[model samples]
Target chain A: MNGLKVIETQDLTKVYGEEVAVDRLNININEGEVFGFLGPNGAGKTTTLLMLLGLSEPTSGKARVCGFDPTREPLQVKRLVGYLPENVGFYDDMNAVQNLLYISRLNGIPDDLAGIKIKELLKVVDLEVDPRKKVGEYSRGMRQRLGIAEVLIKDPQVVFLDEPTLGLDPDGSLQMLDLIRSLSQDKKITVFFSSHLLDQVQKISHRVGIMIKGQMVAVGRIEDLAKEKFGVGQEKYTLEEVYMKYFKEGLL
Target chain B: MKGITTICRKELADHFSSTRFILLFYLILMVSLVTAFIVGSGLRDELKDVAKPTFVFLMLFTSPGKLFSLIQFIAIFGPLLGIVLGFDAVNRERSARTLSKLVSQPIYRDSVINGKFLAGLITISIMLVSIVLIISGLGLLLIGVVPGPEEISRLFIYLVISIFYIAFWLGISILFSVGFRSVATSALAAIACWIFFSFFVAMGASVMADAISPVDQARASLNPELLIKHEQTRKIISLVSPMTLYSEATTIILDPLRKTTQSILLMGPMERLSISRFQSPLPLSESVYIVFPHLISLMAITLVCFATSYTVFMRQEVRST
Candidate 1:
């Protein structure tokens, strides 16, 4: 539970009253790896992340993040793990500095250090704009970048991004994908993000977990999954083909 | 604890800078001051005829202004302040898609609600205290009279009561904000409640009283008993509105000579003569004793509203929108 595996889930389950949203999800994410979580809508990718982050409770299973039980040690987990929800937002009336300052203060970062970190983070994210510009005036891509800066304020060991490249133009998505890739490359931070498009996730994801109907249907390196699904001796199918096989053949 | 303070400070800044808050605040301040100025000018000569004006300073709040007294104005419109501040408290975060990001941070969920509520209460208290002080200062300048110790204490009590009264509405608006998902829906719902309690309740009370005790206006002299019953029923029914409770409680506190909320003028002369009339002002303790139920109910409803919102918000699903 505490070695190279930064996140480990043992049959993590989540049920919302009558329906099971995440059913017995088990995933092992290694340290310093870009783990892509792929699923269609209602596939419970966000719910799994919620349970992993301790924002939600698992119905009958357990999850551990950074060697701490999320449900019991939520503060420690949250302190060390950063989450960027889909379409995340900030106070529009305030500028980037004020918004990030609030978040840093919430994380117990001192004012002097937080100021320095905010400046450095703005530089690192390439959010080059006037300091007086309010977030309301920021373009969608700029807001996403500011979101990355906000997530990095606490210097978390693990960062979870739900649909990081969603709703962005081609150029914005490319920039976001690059930034997400560098999250693990430059900082050695574990980047666990969820996406539906296989083409984009296949580019930067060292390993990926594909969920279908609340179950993890395929998990591992894309090529390894292709080989495992179609057999090594037979013809090799593409990653997209391997992903579609689960839905195409009604394979559970 | 730090999380709570952080959120509270942020919300306070937001309230002070919000245009909606500033507009409503200035409206209340202007109306209250103008009412005090007009009423203060009118009461100078009227109070001179009295033998000994013990709590004349209290008249600035209790005396009838051009339209209504300061106390009545607050009773009628204070809910608007609370509602506007809190109607969109939670839903705004939701619609802006910031609630998920906020909850994901290293803070307890209760901190969000607690911080918003505490900030709102503080803002209301600050506004109420300043308005009272400003009006009192203006009244002093106009009438050339300083407040006595008893009058100051009464004003303090009045301030505390006004805070809770407005806080009760804040709790209500926060409840709607938490219960409803859309900002417009919650705002409309809170305003609807404000209308119901502020205006409709008064009308409904008389209708209910008439139904309970039918008093023919033409033959009312023969059945004074029925007329008295009708009046009692109307007052009882009106007490259901928080506005009624607030005005009644403040009237008792500000005008110590007010022994009861009931209309003694409707009583027969023989029956009225039997009742004791105190020409002098009653003690503060006696007035407080008479309105104990009003104070408790006001407080109880406030706690009930905030508690409901707390439980609901905590239990809700935090979905990423």
Candidate 2:
């Protein structure tokens, strides 16, 4: 809660009828750090992300992004953060550059800067192919790169990546991890990424939070938490191990 | 604005690049051309028969005149084109998960729906105009005759009316697209609604009216003179169809100088019958004014349907997996 907080939630909750997808939970994200949000399927990882991004309404309590209340000033929050959903999609008829350009414009970037930004972001994602080719022709990996390019176009202070490497090959996954890492180091941007891929999350995250059954079970620096929770002799606790341990504990 | 424009350009390009547009254009063109050809040939034959010596001497020969009736067929299918163009509009985006992505952008959700509706409307307008021009061109080339001032005016009014009719279907399609998530579901719903409006509504209304009305069996069966009464009653029932409004509008447009006749007759079993008739031609200006209200109503319905879609779209959550 004290380390250059970029996101803060106070008993943030989301309920659909009688089902509480996200319980009264609280978490804090710091600037210039890669935060990994790890959770099992249907464990409210996405629900939390949606609430943080102002995409979903919290049934009660409050959530803020970049110090602006997500629920009340979504546009202001959105301006400071870029969000990439798990299954990122765009107008398939538009190519990578076109898609990025459109998003840049929507974010109110100046028209003159949009073109340059689109090209730089595309290049950063290593998608330097024909900008005119329709995205429908792109392979899944290419589309993933294009999605990353879109998220980076506005150069926001914070970026949210939801399962960014879900469908990529090993090489593509590695590349995506490298890109996320570089954002924090080179651009001074905060990276809040959610993933079920434990190994990848372990490789890139500075701090990690493990969520289970709509609650955050563990939160700390990756190595410190792994050592403190699992002990020194225990084989290095993969994020998945952390998840399984907490899930079994919650079940018991 | 840039984001919406980008989306619209991409959507328009998809429409043009797809086989759907090509197939629709060809289908409409072929139907219009064939109908025009048949009507032109039929009119030529009828005119020749009317001018024949045998018919000239008889003094009762009447000319059917140009068989402009084919235009009615064209008008009837105009709305189908609109339905075809719009039925898949939003449903396709939902199925493909594109709508979610589009909404994720900072642009207002209404823009996505608005851009799509605008693109579909523009595409349909282009197709309709192209078909009309082709048919008119063929008419000129084949008959070596251009439409006179009156005929041109009538054709213009007919096109305007047809455009309004198409707008009604476009509105219905947008409503269906917003209401249904699955492409098949939207398409089926739209087509079902179209069928109901085009056929079942009129049939159902007439059947219900007949069922509720008291029948006079004694007068109906015993009196020969009552057959005409029954025929007139049936015509009145058929006028309940929307198609009847379209036909009435078409009639007024095509026959601006035609007169309407009113007649009253009295009949009794043991008495002679007396009849009175009145006829007066309606001015072109008056004919235009008469159809204006119906045209406005159809257009208003279209706008209302589109507005409903826009509202639903703005409230929709994007959660494609």
Residue lDDT tens for model 2, B159-224: 677776777687788889888878788888878877776677567655654555534678656764
lDDT of 2 at B152: 63
Give a tens-digit lDDT track for model 1, residues B28-145.
9999989999999998778868877778889999988668999999998999999988999999999998998888889998999999999999999999999998999998999988
Q: Considering only the true interface residues, what is the Cα RMSD of candidate 1 after superposition?
A: 0.8
Which CAPRI level is candidate 2? acceptable
The segments of candidate 1 whose C-alpha lies over 4 angstroms from its true place after superposition are: A1-3, A233-237, A250-252, B217-224, B265-278
**Clash pairs detected, candidate 1:** none
- Which structure among the candidates has the greatest lDDT? 1
User: What's the lDDT for residue A159 in model 2?
Assistant: 91
The lDDT for every candidate, in the order shown, is 0.90, 0.72
Error of 1 at A32 (Å): 1.6
True-structure RMSD, every candidate: 2.2, 5.8
**DockQ in order:** 0.79, 0.38
- In order, what fnat does every candidate score? 0.71, 0.33
